[model samples]
Target: MTNLTCFKAYDIRGKLGTELNEEIAYKIGRAYGQIYCPQKVVIGCDIRLTSEDLKQATIRGLNDAGVNVLDLGMTGTEEVYFGAFHLDVQGGIEVTASHNPMDYNGMKLVRENARPIGADSGLKDIQALAESGHFQEMSQKGTTEQYNILPEFVDHLMTYIDPAKLRPLKLVMNAGNGAAGHVIDALEDKFKQLSIPIEFIKIHHEPNGHFPNGIPNPILIENRGYTSDAVLAHQADMGIAWDGDFDRCFLFDEKGQFIEGYYIVGLLAQAFLLKQKGEKIVHDPRLVWNTLDILKEYDGIAVQSQSGHSFIKDMMREHNAVYGGEMSAHHYFRDFAYCDSGMIPWLLATVVLSETKQSLSSLVEDMIKKFPCSGEINFKVKDTQKTIQKIFDHFADQKPMLDQTDGVSLDFGAWRLNVRASNTEPLLRLNIESRADQNPKPMQDYVDELTQLIQS
Candidate 1:
């Protein structure tokens, strides 16, 4: 029996051989079919080498359970979501490990209309079914068919924003050898026809399963160097990069400075609110002050949600939000069935900058100064529960307020910190944000104190 330790809070992610394999993927697919019992299902994958094999096995399970499959060959997770909603299918699945290492693989599941299935939702049922290792058999076998949704998807995406309004802006795009390169290629061709003076400086655009060095996660300080260098070398207006499956995007300004996802969230929120005034915007609890402030200023309703794609999407749908964003770079749109997209954010951002005649740097400069944050810090620890309890106990009495929406968030007068354990890794992730202080000493002291407490 395969140990389902990897059945996480959000999705199923684990090292390839020991925890996840073809058999387990098949069982998951079978269980998913039994639970959802959809007439038609759509499936897709990233560029990871294991993706195709896992997709095939998963399809086998679905077919065995008499569920017809629409296999979207080699597309991003969002594409699967789009296929599900566009085709009016009952459910969808994307076989991807996202930004994890090459040795890792996972699945992102969604119900009809792109509703996410996380641990609190249908994930636990799927997990139990997989563990039981016994499922009802279907008398009739299902059929499988493959289709290319790229051309239609690209066409549909282009309709959202007008390229004619965009000024000719030179930009650098680093795919980091992930699945984003192909999508970029399709968009570049369309941009050419619009007479947009957009020159794309590409690097590591090819999809390589080995990932040779590391996964294409731009959140890491080390990964930013490559993209920064590309921006400087090309002297572009801005730089954009995506993770393995192109589900989220990272940006660098013309000066090669990496922009935080929080600022991007604000920018996107403001853009959406300007067009659709009074529309609700859903944002994660982590680092939401900037987003909330912007939304309120724009007369947009701000809805705070737990930090996760599943939660954000569900909340967005319930609120009928025009947009949803997370500090982790996931951006969701009501038009896209409330599904997060790695491709749309950059496209929309470019349109925003181009139409306004403002550089990306200038747009986010004020927000950065207003909310100085120490980008997420991860600490490897043996006992996540103990560390969380220690932090909670230490600050519970002294802090003005404490919340456990995502993890442990303590708010003081002008400063807030959230410490949450990663669902996929054995580490505690800490995020701190604060308003202007007389000096940086207080924040530094707080970080030092927390570090010492955890280390000691």
Candidate 2:
């Protein structure tokens, strides 16, 4: 039996040939079928060149293990999540590497009701079973059939905002040549059919696995230029871009300014709170000041969860939270099976823009100015845990408040810093944010101090 290294905290993602491939995918399918023993399963794939082959191999394994499959060809991760809960299928899997490099591909799995199956939640068991390369006897061969879920997915997305309420606005959409193009086209048609005028300036609109316009990640400073430039050139209402799988989206204002995911969390929190007050909002520990302030002003409850999909989804369900967000562009909704949707966030933003009659920048300007953040800085350290302890020790003198919801978060009076090790890599991720009324110097000063501390 070959060792499988693709499994991670939340999903299966790794290099194409060495860590993840067709044989491993087949083993995973067999293992999942044996473990869950579901009558039927939904399967989807992204535009990666290897994802289709992997999807087929997994389907074969599932069929051999007496599990039927519904193939939703080339979709985002959220689509699989939607199909799992919405369709009659008892399980779902999406073959995608998300924002990973061109040389990689992977899968995200969910059980009934689209509940995530993370490392602690049956992923390790699946890995063990796959590594063993053994399975139980099958009763009979299952079957496979094609299924188109685009219309249903788009219909569900429309529930967040009334079509009649959506105003005519010129916008720029950058799909990054991933799975988002299809959904964009579908939504465009829906908008036009409803007479809700929305002019979308499409860039890298076609689905191509090669990623000709570099990787479709707007988080990186370098990859943000295209969206910002197009937004300014077209004088659109806002600019939106997504990762390879289109699970997470990044936004920019009309002035060609990239809005941090942190502010979007607060913006969406307000959007939800306005619709239904006193509802709970879940957020990660990485950035809290802005989101908590918004929730407080709206008289909404705020819940803190760890910074991963599995953690956020579980917390959202537990708290019955209407919305959940992380600083890293993932936005979740209770109506969407507690799964994050790249489509929902933008739609919500557009509705807010139209209703408030505010520019995208103006909508989030005060929040950004009040709670300036360092975004998220990653340090490739030799000892992540030891480095975190060292930094915590250095800052302990002032007697800062501490929270270990996700990572070691130390809160001084004016500014706060979260030092957490990356779940997938050997790097320590640092995020610093200051209170709105305070000077920005404290945030930057702490960043420099922490940078030197990590280096030392």
Candidate 3:
């Protein structure tokens, strides 16, 4: 059996040539076809150069397995997700590395209704089937067709907000030369037709597999300057930058300051709550005070879920949450088949700005002051569990309330700390926050103290 290193905890991602290539992708497609035996599936690829070749190979395998395929051409990860749930197809696959290194490539898979196929879901079985090189011969071959899901997708996105409510605003959009450009163009045209006074100052707007301006991951501080600089230069209302597959979007304020995703959770929760009270809002456990605080004021129910898309989507379904958000910038919507979208958040944000008549920074400024967070800090350690336990032992004397929902969360009266091992990496991710009223000290002090404990 050929072990496949490309299959990760949630999706398929690997270095090019060795771990992933046309042959391996074809086997994966065949494996999925054999296991699920679906009659039809929708597929798409990102801006990566190798993505198209691998996508075609996968299509060939699926066709050989007697599964009809609908190709959406080049698209973001969420587009395939949209196709899976919105269309009549039984499954969807997006060939994308999604902000990984330049030499890497991957795929994200979903079942009917856009339910993710993760490690605990069906990824392991798919991996095993692919590794075994087993095949179930079909009597006949299936056909392939080209489909355009864009118009329907843009129409659905417009449902999230009233175009009339959108006021005159100049916005900066940096696609980072990834797959987001096409969607942005579609939305731009829609805005023009609707006569919405939103102006888009686009940079790195073209789709380029070469990634002229790096990998399009704005989460890293270094990658943020392009969007920030443009926002400042244009004095735009807001700045938006997306990753390679455009599944997650990061936002910047009018001041060109990168806003933490934690605060945006509160902002979006407020936006939803303003529309309807007593609705459920799901959020990850990493940062909670801001979201909980907003939910409390808006009379909305708050549900905490472990981090990651699979867990968030499950919790959203269970509670029928109107919306869900993670500090990592992945936002989910109940109407969108509980799948995360990089497009919807900015739209909702624009709505919030219009209704509140507040600048992006002003909207989140109070929340930031009330509950200061240390953002997410990463520490590379030899033993993740050992380090987590050590931190637990240090804080045991204080007898803080601890919750192990995703990782270790210790809540003190005035402050709290959450440390969790990353699902995709060996690093221990830490987040610390304090109520400004209860503890007025600098957030850096908490960072310093944790840094000492973690390093020691």
Backbone N/Cα/C clashes per model: 1, 1, 0
- Residue-wise C-alpha lDDT for candidate 2, range 324-344, written one tens digit per residue: 999999999999999999999
Q: Give the Cα error of residue 77 in candidate 2, in Å.
A: 0.6
Instruction: Provide C-alpha RMSD values for all models, in order.
Output: 1.5, 1.4, 1.5
Better of 2 and 3 by lDDT: 3
TM-score, structure 3 vs. true: 0.96
lDDT winner among the candidates?
3
Q: Model 3 over residues 1-59: C-alpha lDDT tens digits?
A: 99999998788988999999999999999988888888999999999999999999999
The TM-score of candidate 1 is 0.97
Error of 3 at 251 (Å): 1.4
What does the lDDT come to for candidate 2? 0.91
List where candidate 3 sits over 4 angstroms from the true fold. none
Q: Candidate 2: where is the Cα deviation over 4 Å?
A: 440-442
Per-model TM values vs. the true structure: 0.97, 0.97, 0.96
Flag clash pairs in model 3.
none
